[model samples]
Target: MQVSRTATKEDFNHLRIDDIKQPISESRFDALLEKLQINNLSEDEKDFFQSIVEDRMVTEEEFSTLTYEQTKKIKQFTSRSDLEGNYIADSSIGFEKLSMAPLLSAQNISDDEEYNEAIFNTFKKLNLSQDDGISMLNELGGYINQEEKIIFEDSLTDEQYDSGIRYKTYIGLDMKELVSKRLEELNQGLLETSDEDVKSDYKNMIYVYREIETQYNNIQDKNRVENEAQLEQYTRNTKPNPLYNADVVELYNNITHEYEEKEKKEFDELMDKLDISNLNNREKELFRTILEDKEISNIEMDKLSYEEMKKINQFIFKKDEKGEIIDDTLIRTNSRINALLRTTELTDDETFNQVLFNTVKSMNDIYEINNFLNPILNLISEKFTAFDEVNSINFITEDMNKVLDELIKTFDEHYQETEYDEIKEHYLSVINKYQDLKEQYNKTTIDS
Candidate 1:
């Protein structure tokens, strides 16, 4: 009697169609399962088996695990019928051959019915003639295009209803006409009505309609460009319908400019008061952009280098409850505070000490570094300064709180175990030095 060897890694690499199609004997099956380590099987290997059972090709999600040759063979095998039984012709091999029997077919029928009904109702609501409405619906359904309009040829094929494409075009046209007609009615009402409240309502409606007209024109332009690409011809030569009444659009724009003018005036006043003398030309541009936008998006901000962030930290302002700027808003940067919060990232002791020494020597006042340090120290009350008292400490300002919250949350995710005693010693020394510097600065100020 001949003995069969257990399947190895080599056997799995070039799996035969028979290996997949035929079931192995009980002992051989056990050996194959053990060698493959079913529990340890990669996602692709698991998907491969699942695809075989489902009689479908493996999805792109499993592409990373299987090779090109393996994927092709599996697709062919799963798409075919009965290697062990009778062979089916390639023409009718897959289950998808049944006419309009798939799940998407049902969805298409419902969509067509809903859109066709909507087209009829729009014509009725507008009190337009039903003749054009019938023609539009027929065009959308790909029944006929009597005028030979610019439409996708493939979309008008026997089966394709030009469903999504032609429907979009008709809807855009209907909405544009509807908004234009409404704007004209609103203008007539604005002129006839003496009631201030009613006139204001008319103006607001006019503004909204003008906005819709602008958006519709943008969509029309996009579609024209797309059609030009597909048709390989000049679609732009087609004359466009008249746009929204310019008089109403102009009236709305004037109303919008009043609010814009007020905002621009406030922004100019704020810029005039800001001191950007110390910042370099590039830094000045960055600072101006920041103040104008009044935002420092953490995701975009983190992409900046440490030096750039250090500069930004200096200019970060504090905002009050009503989002109004409070005086004395400039942040004083300290490298030690940065290192502590980003401890896992900034690992070198020499670099940390250099930053700490620089901060201590150049410190101008007691409140120096308060904007950055106070929020972090407040988080650990027992180990740090008196955060609540206004005498020496400046508590966490509103804007600083938002910035610190994001940083601390990020740090918590990447935190690691380190020598607690060493970190504690360094922190205590910095706190003592900061307090001593504050006392000396106060004494000097009183004497002067």
Candidate 2:
């Protein structure tokens, strides 16, 4: 008898159609009938209530005139009832009823007989349940379209659109068919057109459509998977590694492949400046083979002199003031000092000695030799001198002595042969520095 003022038709309509005609058990019928008889109701209302219990059925007509509160009470009582009998049973219909019953009956939403038949028949062929079609209809913008086709609301957000697509795909809708069709059309267009610009446009469109088809296929494949293991395998095999994908790699290559004629001219000029004509046949061949895409191997590179290597380094690894390598050319007429003052273990003495000897012996300039040797010299002076006499003697014999002896001999040889005053001065300076370090080492040892 009580009605809620706030209840609207929209709220009432939100209940599914099948829920309106719910059934009641014998015990529930007895209890509800007793309660209804005691309530203050008109004779007609009392009879309506009694008939619902006696028949063990709640119908649409019986529910229509009831207040929202009365309707809610009936809904609760029916839902909790242990339903009996074949009242409005699915067995009466052709197919099994869905758990989520249709919000609106199909006949109520679709008035056009031809359109309804066509759509429902298609749903049947696709193996989609009647509930699936009805649920889609409830969510669609317009259930009765003149075009006899389904369409989503224009105001649907991206999330809603994607959700709709997923539902449609799950229900066996051909989500990718349009995209696949477009790709076939583009393939034909590509073959028909000889114009490069038109061909490019067609190719781009084909790529886009193919990607769309692949995405839909991914969704379909995921949904069709029977178990976790199959899904895991499918995901692992299909997921793209951007670094290794041929299309992605080719795209990046094309972006960075902008080699200009000006760069080639500059390289040629640099080779000419370095007197490539004076290089021996092997050296010339090695130098010529090093290009933007090609690099000289470590074995082949070991054949070059220290001065030649220095020149090549200046050209190849030219760094800006910020130490970032740039495309600008670097022309070095002489090698500059580049000392690496790092700790060296006595255990690695033999390898270090060989590398140092090879590097120094190949140096044609005093600056290059001094620059390379100064770091090693400083390490021994600071680190080795601190060692006790016994340790120092052992370390010197194992590591320091071989490289130091070779370096001193090379410096002496360079000093005697060089005609340049600058080279001679640097050679003396380095030799003197080594002597001072050695004297310190000896003093430290003698006192110890």
lDDT of 1 by residue, 296-354 (tens): 43222333445555445444554545665554344322343333223222222323323
* Steric overlap count per candidate: 0, 0
**TM-scores, one per candidate:** 0.22, 0.20
Against the reference, the lDDT scores of all candidates come to 0.37, 0.41
- Using TM-score as the measure, which candidate wins? 1
In the predicted model 1, the residue pairs found to clash are none
lDDT by residue for model 2 (310-363), tens: 344434434445655544333212122222111122224434533444445445
Model 2, runs deviating above 4 Å = 1-239, 242-251, 254-265, 272-448
